[model samples]
Target: MKRFFPIVFTLLYMLAMLKPVLPVFDYVINQDYIAEYLCINKDKPEMHCDGKCYLMQMLEEQNNEKKQNLPAIDLKEYPIGFVTLINLPSETTTTTPQKNHNNYHNQYRFLTSEQHFHPPIFS
Candidate 1:
């Protein structure tokens, strides 16, 4: 179940990631077979290709397939942006508070009676 699925998924993902190396391993394991049949330079053994060309072709094909599978991005397309312009008057003015202003007081007090502190009664 739950645990088994993650393990299987991880293994599959790793195998997929290692796809490019598979051809190399195959060539290494079956060098004689590949050189005899699948190699491009098998007729001329002077190059000592030993299926290297086939392995390279396989890697290139895999890379091409990966590139083809991806979606291409459009560099010309962009999001539209909007900007707002604001206008302000050039003249500026400042005002001073009066000497007796209540805001000048450092202490504060609430004016309440005993009745105000009690909760309201329902009829």
Candidate 2:
């Protein structure tokens, strides 16, 4: 009984950590936190990229596209018209500029009094 305490506690701690209620079977069993998402061929025994693996081929295609690329895009080709701005709910009724309130500074303002400072600004 005396020697069994350490072993029992260790087992209980491990069991509590596993948290089988949540989906962590992949991390617990397979030791992988995230499941692989890369496309894998079912028929092939080894990784055999039909063409994609070559870096040079991809770069060449990109360069060729850049050479034939148009100077500017035509908005007519797109189904939706170009939108510059979006209107949302606003609170203010008047277009007039708001006056400065000195409530926080005890009614003393540097800019309003036409005062300027050099470097080491805080001092």
Candidate 3:
């Protein structure tokens, strides 16, 4: 009984030390956190794009100018097909639906399924 008591106590102590090493599988990085990390303004997220958008706009303008300079090609005169204009969605619109606070929490809850099968290891 004395030996068993020491064994049990050692086991409990090891478990206590290992408890903190367990990974929090439900932990998730949020968009707000990303924004904060990137030092982006919450009110004007467009500012996150910085001058990239402006540069793209300038390139598009140049492309348009080149297209205008080219001689007009009539589709009826040639058998080959030609693309006139490509319509793309505005950058201001988000393709993916925004996740609300509840949705974000729900996503994190679902992410814990992996933890049930394969628990994460913390270093």
Candidate 4:
């Protein structure tokens, strides 16, 4: 009976270790957390890849559907035309501020939480 117990225990241990080695166990388990929620609402939805919102796949499909047969011309093979290059002025020009002076400090204040006073101040 002692030999039987040890055999049974060893068999159970072996069974425990016989699980499949899953590299992509994370993606299979956490599908909801990795969904492209933005793309879900898109007019023409696209495939979700690594939880990123991409328009590349949709654009490629649309391009393929609208593709027309045209001769592939190489621009480099054509003779070079007269090239006119205009050099930009080296000096920097300052322009009037688009916004008022008060709006300048508002950028930083928007990012940070507003500071509040606990009690009314006495003059």
- Evaluated with lDDT, which candidate comes out highest? 1
RMSD of each: 17.0, 21.4, 35.0, 30.4
Candidate 4 ranges with C-alpha deviation above 4 Å: 1-21, 36-45, 50-123
**TM-score for each model:** 0.57, 0.19, 0.25, 0.18
Against the unseen true structure, what C-alpha lDDT does each candidate score? Answer: 0.83, 0.52, 0.56, 0.54
Candidate 2: residue pairs that collide: none
Native-to-model Cα distance after best TM-score fit, residue 54 in candidate 3, in Å: 0.5
- Candidate 3 regions with alpha-carbon error over 4 angstroms: 1-47, 75-123
Candidate 3 lDDT trough over 10 residues, lowest sum: 21-30
Q: 24-80, model 4: which lDDT tens digit per residue?
A: 343345545645353343444443254333334444554565465456779988856
What lDDT tens digits, residue by residue, belong to model 2 across residues 1-123? 987999999999998776432333433343321223322332453665322223334456656766788477776787565666788888787778879885675765555655666678575
Candidate 1 per-residue lDDT, tens place, 6-109, comes to 99999999998887788778888998898889999878989998888998898898889989999998755643445455687677767776577555756778
Please estimate how well model 1 matches the true structure, expressed as its whole-model Cα lDDT.
0.83
Q: What value does the lDDT take at residue 28 in candidate 1?
A: 87
Better of 2 and 3 by lDDT: 3
- What is the full ranking by TM-score, best candidate first? 1, 3, 2, 4
lDDT of 1 at 117: 60
lDDT-wise, the better of 3 and 4 is 3
